[model samples]
Target: MVAESGNGVHLLYPVDLLNDEANRDLIKGVLGTVAERFDDDDTKLDQSVFNAARITKLYGVVANKGDHIPLAPWRLSRIINAPERNAVVTIEQLRALVPVAPAKLPAAKRRGNYPAFDLLDFLTRLGIGYRQDMHEGRERFKLDHCPFNADHGCGEAAIFQKAGGELGFKCQHASCVDYRWQDVRELLDGPRESRAGRATANGNRPGEQNAATGTAGALRVTYRRVSDVQAQPIRWLWQGRIARGKVSMIAGNPGLGKSQLTASMAAIVSTGGLWPVDRTRCTQGNVIFLSAEDDAADTIRPRLEAVGADLNRVFVLDAVVESYTADGAEVRRAFNLKNDLAKLETLLIEVGDAALIVIDPVTAYLGDCDSHKNAEIRALIAPLSELAARHGVAVVCVSHLNKAGGSDALMRVQGSLAFVAASRAAFLVAKDPAGDGTRRLFVPMKNNIGNDQTGLAFAIESAEVPSAAGHIETSRIKWGAESVTVTADEAMTSQGDPEERSALKDAKQFLIELLKNGALSSKVIRADANGAAHSWRTIERARVALNIQVNRAGFGKGGIWTWRLPHTPPNTAIESIERHTNCAAAYEKSGGLCEEKPKRNEPDWEEF
Candidate 1:
């Protein structure tokens, strides 16, 4: 048995430190010490004892007189039963047995292909640690210390080396001349550099040299002739140059036959007929007329037939398919332009392309008009515009005037100003101020893409036509008109009370005189009436009292206030003045003068 101070017992024949018996006895003593430290009932103690016995047997430790003897199971059993009291082993003692010298192994047996020492060095730098499992007599490498080791092993030392420690161990192979750390690091870093070089040379790898080069020369190129191209201006086939993709508001009092006139226009376009415009002809193409308010069979079909529209060319959507529900209430949904565009694409695939798509009364399709929210409205209409542009279809969205009457123009549309702003073109339909009920006026309110100054005045008549079943059908017409007029008191009293009538009468007279020349400043007029100290509140009160029309003109320093006459006929004005004068005379006869008393700077002369 070989022994040294602080070293555990080593049973060896020649007492060689590197002999199998020395290593086995040393491991046996360590395992015995571990078993004693733990309780007998502990499963780990029994497992450690069994593992140490098996490791000793594999290392060729046995009691026999030969160069290599078969390990004896009885000898191991005896050592386990009569464990050495003072000869004990610890984690530190087991780790100290690991060979630190590369030349320890026989030089003749060295493998030429052994990894370099830097490889191991790199691994240690990358936070690798190791432990020797004396329980199995095989050195086990671990990234952390073995908790079972009583001395805590080399865990602290290993961690310290990983954090920038230069200390390193020779390769485990005794003949390997290189250090473990240097060989390992060189192997890892060398291959990485080679891979990077190959990738750069390829120039096709994603997010590499190729990507950078490709983006460097990315520039938008546009071609144009040096001189202006001698191209003829393309004119719209429709008379009066109906601009492409614009909203034309067609409004009238509830029963002014707006729908009938719109149907007539649709019929002319569907059959490629002439519109009222002299120089322009209708751009003959397929026409889609969506009327949510009218039934295809009863109202729409007969009207189109009476106007001599080609039945094959005109497509009327079934009311059932177009209906939608909002807030549990069933309402005729307005034609969605996006949906119609998709449907139009399908239609084009089947029957060439379409030229016109008309949506009557855009309000019915808009689920929420009273909502002041702008984003919601834009989201809804954005799809519609995209559809029109994608399909190259001219969309004519029809809208109605607000109940509030004034300028029978685009400004009177029922919803947000965005409605007019979004549309490329817009028109307004109003009762002719000079004609009777027979005459109607179609005024162009906004013409962003074309001229819209002149309006079309036509007399409307419902004519009868024989259908396929021989039934008489009525359709509206566009004929010559005689006159149209709406009296101020008649218009006001038609809906409101006597107070409204009086207010409207005074307002109409005041506006007619003020706007007869042009627009006038409300501030200037107010100052003249109420001195230089006149307040805006007083001006507003006078506006309400007199019922004059007022609107803002500009902003900041350039801002001004302007007034205009309500859009009413001259006869309506003359009649309103006469009625107010008669009412004042009647009040005077009844002992209550209705006339305003002149101010101190004014003359007071009364005349009927």
Candidate 2:
């Protein structure tokens, strides 16, 4: 396209050059590669400047002058979008696109500058130097003069435009590594109006209400058609036991090793221990705990060390400052989960990549909220659940069971039903009905993410830990050999009172006294119990319940199975068993009653 003034000075510009992304950049190269000369005044065009056909066709929006065509922001897309290819100028309609706030002389500048501002030019104008080079297949500038460390002139600072046309800045220099992209914007283009009503660099208009949130612009919430929603794979913190980015509840009676088991898991996360059924290694990260119940030094830390956790990665969040004293000192109080969640969020940010968080007995930190109230419980847990999701951390909320024994383990959780309802998964730590009281089992009570998995067994072992005072005794978790094939409901079934467990224990002693001298076949043992006027099936149960081994030793026609005590001496066993033989209450107290003997023709009775 060519244009001539009434005085016959002609200007020529290639149409293709106007649409190039680097139109400003090529101008320098174009001037260096081509020569320019003034034309004679005697030269004449076929028509006058105002009557030129191409001027009318490509004028875009003629704001105030004909030489300067104000490219309409609305029709700039004609380079590709508009089919007619008509670039007719609309008068002054594109003035908003070329804001003249910085145009001191009011349109003295030509079309050489395109971007509202150039970062490189801004830096150079500020006496900062730069070097242009190719980066990631795109042109970028590396600072020859670091604004933060001008004396060192660190070469790590770089500037480039992002895919969406936003300018980005990054500095690998240690001193300026923390500088944000927006900080660079403030330095290049004068500091932006940092009020709510100001347009954000990301394109949000000042004080505009977000459509999705229906509130002040806080964050951008994007949506997609329901059919376009992609499904995310379920992530597990402990295989199927707990889920990541979700709140999991652990409920149990006190002293059931709930804290110890959780500490053991935290230790595993800190150390990158065996994770899956194959025991493959996973990445290690930090474990944070807000244990309101246990003493940090003696209980939490010792247990962590006992479980082989990286001590450095184990953090205990005790409390944050609640108020400032009159003397200008701080009055600190325990961190309350309901009120001080923002403080917890700050703590999570400080300890980034946290893998797990433990709020021992979440009710303890409920502050003034009533744990038993469903609404209040929901309110207390909502922020925490969101925090867990935002940080991709598994938040384990420890809880004790309601005193009501023998109810649904989920309902037994000491709080409103929301305690279990709000959690994605809930677990129960109970005395192993099959093992001694020292052994505990982790049973999945509720799992909304997947099928309820088989339970795992663990026991508490006494470990001596070094403390400021001296060595102290604390318990650490000892996982069982394999996961148990028991449901939480099944496990809780035998979770009877202490009296019942004691009765069964006493019956075992009675069985030992009855069989201490020699091994007896099942048939003969039942015969002896029947003859002695004791519950034969109950004695048989006791015989099988203890550590006694059952074997078949007789050969040929005399072959028979016998139950025998392995380590118990006949003399000592006889003396001990005497105390329990006459007590029928042992069966009654232990809730261990014998079923009637089966008929010979029917199926044989199963050994206890």
lDDT per model vs. reference: 0.49, 0.63
lDDT of 1 by residue, 1-608 (tens): 33211112333222224436556656544444554465342243322332223444323343322112122112321232233455444546664543343222222221222222342445566554665332233233443532111122344222112111122333322122222333233323432222232322334432343454554222223357957767644245354445434333444445666777777777777878877645346767777777778888778878888888887887865433454566565554444542454654566456545767677766566543221223333444556666666655666767765544332244346554446656766665556644464666665666666666566666666677776777865757674433223432222223334454455455445444444534445544554445534345444544554456666555664555666444534343344344434444555587975463222221121210
- Model 2 bad stretches (over 4 Å): 1-224, 276-280, 467-470, 497-608
Residue range 1-608, candidate 2, lDDT tens digits = 33323222334432333533343333322332232222223442321122112343343332222112122112221122224444544323333333334223222222222224455567667676777776533357777755534433547677765322335567775444445445555443432332124444445653566666676543333457988888888777666666779999898889889898888888888998975343645468898998888898767888887878898998999778878978999888878877799998898899887989998978878877755445556667777899889888999999987654443566567756667877999998988877766788888899898668677787788898777888878888777777787778667646756665565566777676655554445655676667765575456557656767776644664455566676645443343233223222244556865333212222121322
Clashing pairs in 2: 60-89, 61-89, 61-90, 197-206
Error of 2 at 474 (Å): 2.3
Error of 2 at 466 (Å): 3.7
Best candidate, TM-score-wise?
2
Q: Which residue runs of candidate 1 sit more than 4 Å off their true CA positions?
A: 1-237, 245-253, 277-279, 319-335, 338-340, 366-372, 389-392, 404-408, 468-470, 481-608
